[model samples]
Target: MYRDLTIGEKGKDVAQLQKGLRSLGWPTGADPSGTFGSGTAAAVRRMYAAMGYAAPLTASAVTPSANAASDAAGVGEGGEQPGSDIEMGRSSATPQPTEPESTVMLPVSEAVFVPSLPARVVSVPVQVGDTVKGPVITLARGDMTLTGFLDPSEQRLIRTGMKAEILAEATGVHTTATVDSVGAVVTPGSGADKTASDSSAVTPQNGSAYVPVKIKSSGRWDKKYADQDVRITITAAATSGAVTAVPEAAVSAGADARTTVTVVLTLNA
Candidate 1:
């Protein structure tokens, strides 16, 4: 028997499995990339339905008719005899309102199924023209996150309000972001260590811990830059300020602890 297919698996085995499903008229969602993912799992379920197997049941799968029948069954077992006036009245009573169709209906993609336990797979081992059963691929889904590390000094200079300038070295495109947090505990090292920094300035040869920094950006960022090494600049520092100077001898401290500067004006006749 061929080994079971699962998510995170790749190579000729996955491609072979995908090709087999396609021959059976199942859609794998995309061209066989040799990587089993959610799209592949969906195609497997389609195959199950094709072989007269129903998709696993879920709370959302209960149909309106099934619910009505269940309710009727409960009433029938309440000691009501057939054709009795009480039973007749109950039957003729106003029907209970059901949830709006829009609220109860689920999209085909969102439907969750629970197939029989111990899972079933194709009885016949995967072959040139044989079909298989059970999940061909497992799936894991979650939101993406961006994590980075900063030097202790750099971390102290950063705060939540600081705007981050992200530069893509390949495309020279820029994206704007804001600091979300600065980690409390220092980590021994981070992804940035393995990567070459934009600047060749001196760096600590001995491994130095870094504070984790999380960044939040508005709108969408090009997925092409994901995991690709990029440069981040903290642009929230004071770039400009007005300056005035007074001689120290002309300044005095008041009782209130505030500094006082006396400017003498001489009037000439």
Candidate 2:
């Protein structure tokens, strides 16, 4: 599935999606966030039309879509999801993740540099074909950021405080992540727009203009990705710390029976 595919921190998935549609003349008008959303779906539908396909599920905005809210889901169980042209033709010989060909209008790749071993020298081992995971910025230190443009025919979810997933290429092992931040603005991808920050090497940056949330990691979160294909899922959720763990199958039983899982708390004091 390789959902995580951004190169560095702040990878622009939405913009890339929108830009693809724009290239096809649909125009999503959304700057990429490297995060998939409503606008991205619309873009995919537009692409499908250009490819001569009938109104696809995504484009059928009238009826509620099952995977409507989801973005960049990985290949399913060693096979592509049915009805998705992009995955159906995936080459088994060189099996790997690929965006749905029928959905994506155009593809865009940004050039990036990977840090060399010993954390001293830096090199650009992977490029276009490679993928990335969450916050490529934190790992691709010293690397620059690339922002994408938008087209006119796009939509957005625009729910502030709602969670989102990120898929980025990593430099090391594992390429997946959870939501670490949320949007404060409600953008409909009809040309969505949106920030601030500082620290006294530790304190906080007193802003001069409108301020943006500035959160400093406690250094506990993952940060190994540098230049690899990664997948992120912001949709799935659990309580902080996942205090109560349960198998996926158990979830339904737990929900239907109103089973209350205990949240054990231990104080070291």
Candidate 3:
């Protein structure tokens, strides 16, 4: 009997196993190759089902029968040849051929992961019939929040609850948002934090430090704007009524540590 070929095994033997499965009308999900991955394993399961195996097969390895090559040559169980379904008036005394030991391919159970909450697919790096080596897809959960980084001077002027205007230059979509929070700690400008949306007008060229800020849209945001760079204008301070103005020369500080503005009154008699 040939040695068992299991998952994660590579090389010519795996390739041969893939070919054998294809001959049995099973799709391996990839071109016949040396790697025995999930796709190959799934194909093996399909082969088992076609062979009338009961549910919950125990073995995960493929054990080639001593006459594996002959079986792959179109000779099936009970000495039945491929495409010769006509049982021409055979004699009743004819003895039936015993099933071959090597033709049986066993399947092992594999675990599947499922997410609890619904999510949006951000990206897929691999396609059908392609060999999967690493990450296959990216997912985004819940509503998207915007994050941005600010330089030291800019951080000092920003505060939570301030109104901000978000502009996407490419689409010219304008949306109103509010400052949800301001990060307490400072981080290097080069390492822009990703926990929030990045809305910087221009990235720092000299690698200066920056503070993280979180912003939330006033309403549901458009899905098309996700991951796109945007410009943000924040209203740090504002005034509603009239205010007094003074020249720099008329203002002074007294010894009492109080600010005084000199008023010059001219009377014409």
Candidate 4:
């Protein structure tokens, strides 16, 4: 039911055309003046181009043969190529059917403004301004596993099948997971140790190196939080089950070759 109108034409239809273009993110400049002017025509071409209905218009882009079609279509210069079915000067009451344009869809590179090709983002590769081949985004496909660092001492308390609580800070959602694997203790040097005279002078705050822990998330999570931080808490042992315990630093070998605690346990109640 669409009728084609061209430049210098005045009607409410022209105003409606301008309004539609504005809604589609194409600004028709300062006026929606009820006349098909150059501005409205240019916006129409952009709309057509975005929808892949026509080749994009550019000052130096359209060929001479294409220009002739553009002129006849009543679309501004550089507009979509007119179809072969359109009659140039027919004044019949019944509208003529037109063949769809036969032009190939413009390449996404010409239509899309992204610096990289459309792709699933896996991880950031090149930094800003770095040149890349196809696909700006990295692609990844798999079930998600949680990776985190745990104190070497804490790692010893965890084993496969241990339940973990993962809290998403953004949504305040708590998700349950199970320990997948606890890697061997890794004594990664603290940053300050790299520049310190004595590497031992800079030690981890916990007095122990860290170990890698992998957990499998058991609940669904929004992909928006992919590669983001989450709080992981694992309950490996119950304190209520312990009848006696001593801090690591408090126990030492005595003259009798027995471990002695700084303070003796006394049950008063």
Candidate 5:
């Protein structure tokens, strides 16, 4: 009275066979299409093997009784039943707690990062298992620049666009650079007015006045020089043509607050 589903067959009976295979965790290629194909034939052989049947199926024909056996194995075509953990090859008599399925999703903006320009990561402030409270990573780009601090008197002479000489003591490389910028504000106790090429270098101390200055090389700078101490000499001023000079001792301030230079004249007899 029950019909057998075989390859090349179509209609609702073939669809039932496909559903039965899927219920037993043997996928029949796709959703029940009501037409038996090569995929269905392969799944039929696998199903027969799982059921401990040594005899090969006839032309991949699935009998109605076999569909009933598959349904009883674990889950029905409709849904999963209580204590029906057939995928594990076992079943429990007592009903177990069913955990609800959970899914987590994040917004596109929070999930992706788009930087304004091309950059390279300099450092990561956190490690694995550390909670992120502030900045996670630092990025840098473009040419490298040198940062140095100067005393108030020296700062007054250094200005942006001035030519500077750079010397790396470690490598003995001398290079020409230009003053990129000069900080207008002076912080106090800023330790010794030293040059720093990285973040770990000497920092400003409390109550010391020091102005920060930035200098950039005129040409390509080697990355190996980064973070190393370097000497910077900025040409505060320059002049051309002949000029008058005098000794330090001869130059003096008069009582009237006027500068005067002592001149020595030799008489020829």
Candidate 6:
């Protein structure tokens, strides 16, 4: 029984997704703007791999037809038989290979900085002499918003009131503060060439529909720096314990995707 089969960001937006999902049978009440929410993910997980959309979390992305069903449940470590490879040469001294290991699950996130918004500087909202808050962030708008989303599995890694160091864009000076809000409203849509880090490419669909975050606090800005932009850094949560973890820096594609590992080793010359 396939429930949620979302043809999301790669397709429509969240509301449209929800509508389409409902039309397709899994009525998540999700807005099809292509947002990746709890309702949509759960539905997809149950309905996906079985329908061949993707594979389940495992030791590798490259699945094995002969071993997949056997490995479906957790394989023991070192589950290989060296003798099986030899043709009629049964060696009593061969060692067995290890079984597949369990995978660790972590919440991944994409970020948006103040400069990344399609809103543009549009006259820096604050002036140098004006008072401002410490925590500052900007949301993207448009087709990208609906397509760009943070998996709900990653929600636990981010939180409100987390401490964030802030920096002004023009002056290159920075300050410190704590987070005040986490938007429950996710942006929908994606671009062929855009990424979480590309500021200039994040233009919104409706133009004025971006949800830039306004930090709430009290501090006087150096008047000369009022027109500058701000940026914030948030901490990512940890999901350690025999699970797979690929550092974001190691991935070449802006780490825009995730997958299981088949082999990990170092060649010692």
Which candidate tops lDDT? 3
Cα-based RMSD of the predictions, in order? Answer: 22.2, 30.2, 14.9, 16.1, 19.9, 31.8
Model 1 C-alpha lDDT per residue in residues 72-123, reported as the tens digit of each score? 6566566667767557555744355554331111123422332222222223
lDDT of 2 by residue, 1-269 (tens): 11332212134444554455565577544535564544655665666676787543311113323353233233334455566554543333233443433332222332123323223223445556667653233332332211111121211422224343334544434422322333233233222232111111111123212212222223333444333234433333356664745655544335467755444469997
Clashes of each: 2, 43, 4, 1, 5, 40
lDDT tens digits, residue span 1-269, model 5: 04545556677656766776686688888534888776776777677677785423342223345444554554434465644354443333223444442222111222113223333456779898998798777667655567776776786788789988888999898888888888755554443333322444454555566677888777767766766788888877668978877989999998999999899999999
Model 3: per-residue lDDT, tens digit, 1-269? 14445556677766766776676688678644977776777887786677786423233434445454444443334566644442332322234355432322333222212233334666789899999898777766666767666776777899999999999898888888999898854544434443333433333355556666778888767876776788888887779989877999999999999999999889999
Question: What is the Cα-based lDDT of residue 220 in candidate 5?
Answer: 62
Worst 10 residues of 6 by lDDT: 104-113
Model 6 Cα lDDT, one tens digit per residue, 120-200: 222335566767765233433421211222344555655666666666677788766555554443343533223332444
Model 6 CA lDDT for position 165: 63
Q: Is candidate 3 or candidate 6 better by lDDT?
A: 3
**Model 1: residue 239 alpha-carbon error in angstroms:** 2.9
What's each prediction's TM-score? 0.34, 0.18, 0.41, 0.40, 0.36, 0.27
Count clashing residue pairs in model 5. 5
Q: Which pairs clash inside model 3?
A: 65-102, 146-197, 147-196, 147-197
TM-score of 6: 0.27
Candidate with top TM-score is 3
Cα-lDDT of candidate 2: 0.36
* lDDT, candidates in the order shown: 0.58, 0.36, 0.64, 0.60, 0.63, 0.43
Candidate 2 ranges with C-alpha deviation above 4 Å: 4-14, 30-32, 54-269
Question: Which residue pairs collide, candidate 4?
Answer: 122-138
How far in Å is the alpha carbon of 195 misplaced in model 3?
A: 9.0
Q: How big is the positional error of residue 212 in model 6, measured in Å on the Cα after superposition?
A: 4.9
Query: Which scores higher on lDDT, 2 or 4?
Result: 4
Off by over 4 Å in 5: 1-139, 188-207, 238-269
